[model samples]
Target: MSAWQDDATRDLMGLGGRLALLVRGEGSAVWDADGNRYLDFLGGIAVNSLGHAHPTFVNAVSQQAAVLSHVSNYFATPQQLELAATLKRLAGTGEAGRVFFANSGTEANETAVKLARLHGNKVGKKGLVSLNHAFHGRSMGALSLTPKPLYQDAFRPLLPDVTYIDNTLEALDELDWSDVAAIFIEPIQGEAGVVEHPAGFLRRARELATENNALLIVDEVQTGMGRTGDWFAFQREGIVPDAMTLAKGIAGGFPLGALVTFGEASELFYPGTHNSTFGGNPLATAVGLAVVAEVENNDLLANVVTRGEQLRAAVTDLPLVTGTSGKGLLIGIHLDGPHAGAVREAAHRRGLIVNAPTDDIIRIAPAYTIGDAEVEEFTRLFAAALADVNGTASEENNA
Candidate 1:
């Protein structure tokens, strides 16, 4: 391991140790201290929408920093307002929609949790619903919506009184809407091995939430910003969520997030209801605007669809590969055995970065700027990794 990796293991909190000590990156590749190049299929967990060191992102950061960086939320900046309008348009919120800025996706989801409370307060409801194995964020309120024991166990006595359900229409119908303030959906549960909901589940949830007067909040933090072949995965289902949370690729790897509310839900927050010191400041919003413009003008959505299809097709035939899940650049390769860990290590040895969210799933969320070269190279490295692991599955394995 490199010096940084040793320091990370000794000093970093929670993180056991570092993987490779990545020193620099450009496009879809990174280099470690030993000068070894690795194909970055993870893309900062879908944050590097434009890959690393893109001119647009760098320029935006530099220009905004040179001018003005941050001010209190008491004051609004041009970049902030423009980003709000852009998010409203992209999210189809129209005139009735409103935006709340934050510094991370968990903070955005926390805002959504509060919105659920505000909606439920008038109706005497104190319940929330989320799918099983969902990973919203690590904060208390957002952690409540995330129903994993591993994530919520130590932090027991979670708030929000959330009910966990499977990704089925029957499970959704079983939710006690009489006491439900909101139902949170991840659209595509990226953290849960790229699990996609059953067909039409989103639409049905929308109708049910409406009939029950519950807010339908989609956690688009992983699926939005054109990662799922569209601006948001809910659009593919043709459902208009009452609210949605965004981050992770919104600003091309910048630490920014947003909570967007629609219709009456937009009217929930008054002044002092919530605030963030570094939220929607000039620096973050300026970078976000640049990222959005690049994705839109270059038609990255189409590239996402095409490259995603290419990746799925290229890897589906590998040995020990059961199938794939997810859409667009966010994909999960399913394994027939509990050897995803072995395969991940093998991939890293071969200089291809991949993530295994479960024992049998390897998730890949590459940059939207990927071309045929990246797909082809990923297939070569990943196929070799699979073969190397399947031949000898007893090797020590970790991310």
Candidate 2:
């Protein structure tokens, strides 16, 4: 094993084993310690919204650090106030909307959980609902909503009154919404192999939640910030969730998370209900502002749309690929067999970076700003890797 890998294994709790000692990155590419360059198709699990080391993101952090970094939420800064307004604007939450910033997707979801609890306390409803096969987060509250045995078994005696259902209208229909305080839904279950809810599922969920006065909280931690061809995945369904959690790509790789509340849901939290020491610190919010502005000014969502279709088209016909799922930049390459792990290794060895979220699904969520060159290079590397593994090429090969 490499020296860095040994050191990492001794120190870090995750990463399985260090795949590469990534030293530097620019645009849509990264270089390992040994100077091996690879196209970054994973984009830090879709966190690197502007790709690695974007100038705007860098400048924002530097400028904010120089001016002000943290005030412990006792006093708000310009970045904090501005970011809140920007988020509300983007979410179309109007004047009644409110924002609470945290440091990660998990933290954002945790805040949403608090909102759910607050709703329960305010009314007679106390039940919380989340979908099966969903990946909310690993924290106690978020984990309770995540029904998977592997993640939940070790952390037994989780939050109570949490129910799980599939992301289908039929599943939603069976639920007694009046008893539920909140229903947490993800437009696309990114960690669950980029699985998307059925068509009209979100809209139907909205109707049911409204009819019974249940809070509909959308977890856009993975699917938001234009990853799914829209500002937020819920936008595609034309539904405004009662509350929404956002992170991952929000700060262009900076550690930032936000809980956005809509309408009456904004009234759920009082002053003493929540606090985070480093949440929405000036440095993080400034970076977030820069990232969001860059996306808006550059029209990167359109790029995500075109690049996603381009990359998906380039790879769907590959020998080992069965089909593709998800939307825009967030895509899952379905394999013919349970060879996602093998294909991931093969792709990594061939100077491409992807991940196997499941035995049969290789998730690819690249930079939203990826262009023709990046797409073409990704195709070449991915195809060569697939050929290396299965030794088959399509008659309609484009690479």
Candidate 3:
């Protein structure tokens, strides 16, 4: 067998049966071993927010590597401090915020869950609540906070005192709020087909948590950093979570994550409570600060808003499309039938890229800087795929 085939065969089967193409990538494009170039709509599942090989990101990483890279948690680094300051400002945490850095989304969420529990203990609460269809992370702690059974079923005996609630404020009704440690939620349900909680659901959750003395932890790992055309998605909802976990786009594809806490909640993580050896490494934080600066200076959030409207408008009138859900660039189009996989395959054949988490929903989280022409191209290609599938069905019926 060929080397690539051998590698594929040896790989684990944990990816839900979806095999990936081995490719060489460059800004918004990837070439398979067979020299097929595809426009990458997936963008490493929304991690490459700055596209690929962005000059600013490249320069920042190079410069920081020359200066310093890793320092143990015992010592402070200027890059880490600067990045934390920038994030605090972006998150609107004012002067009362503090940050704990980690190396990935799961670690970031792990930190958030731990801090929530600590805060709950401080206030004498006992339980925690998260929405159904939510995905926080894969670690035991974050996994416990994740409500999806399929993801959690395999790993039983997760942390105790974690409960699942519906994605509506009504789900909070009649609960003994006094025992709830905190209410954790994602701004947008990225993995569960981009489901969004109802309007005012977040605000109402905040109100309930405050009334009952609980913390509100917003998992913005996938929805923050202009992915939804805002610094943070919760800002648009008019609610500020007590604690927030961020990753994915924070470092523009570098492995980095952070937990930011405001008010008295920042004191939950006392010294010696938690630490990551490579968490706030100079290289990652330096790259992160650059990503944040680029986002602000280039006004990429504005671009996300403009391009999101174009992409949504192009598909709003399609017969096969039921509707598009989400805000800004993190969009999900619901289709009339379970043809998401087929449509995605067809788009791939046509040198386009997309994802299907559900049988009928196609998730489109392309880089925020994706151009209008690319969006138009994807819309045309998707429409063609839909028509082709319908035509095939009609012919089969006639035969």
Scored by lDDT, the top model is: 1
Residue 63 CA displacement from its true place in model 2, Å: 1.5
lDDT of 1 at 294: 99
- Which of the two, 1 or 3, has more lDDT? 1
TM-score of each prediction: 0.97, 0.96, 0.95
Task: Please identify model 2 stretches exceeding 4 Å from their true place.
Answer: 392-399
Per-residue C-alpha lDDT of model 2 across residues 1-399, encoded as one tens digit per residue: 989877888888973656899999999999999999999999999999999999999899888888888889888899899999999999999999999999999999999999999998888889999999999999999999998898999889999999999888899999877689999998999888999778899999999998888999999999999998899999989989999999999998999999999999999899889999999999999999999999999999999999999988998788888889999999999988777887899999999999998998999999888899999999999888888767532433444
Worst 10 residues of 3 by lDDT: 13-22
**TM-score of predicted model 1?**
0.97
lDDT of each: 0.93, 0.92, 0.86
Q: Which ten residues in a row have the lowest lDDT in candidate 2?
A: 390-399
Off by over 4 Å in 1: 394-399
**Which candidate wins on TM-score?**
1
Clash count, candidate 2: 0
- Candidate 2 local Cα displacement, residue 349, angstroms: 0.5
How far in Å is the alpha carbon of 274 misplaced in model 2? Answer: 0.6
Ranked candidates, highest TM-score first = 1, 2, 3
- Which pairs in model 2 have colliding backbones? none
Please list the Cα RMSD from the true structure of every candidate, rounded to 1 decimal place.
2.4, 3.2, 1.8
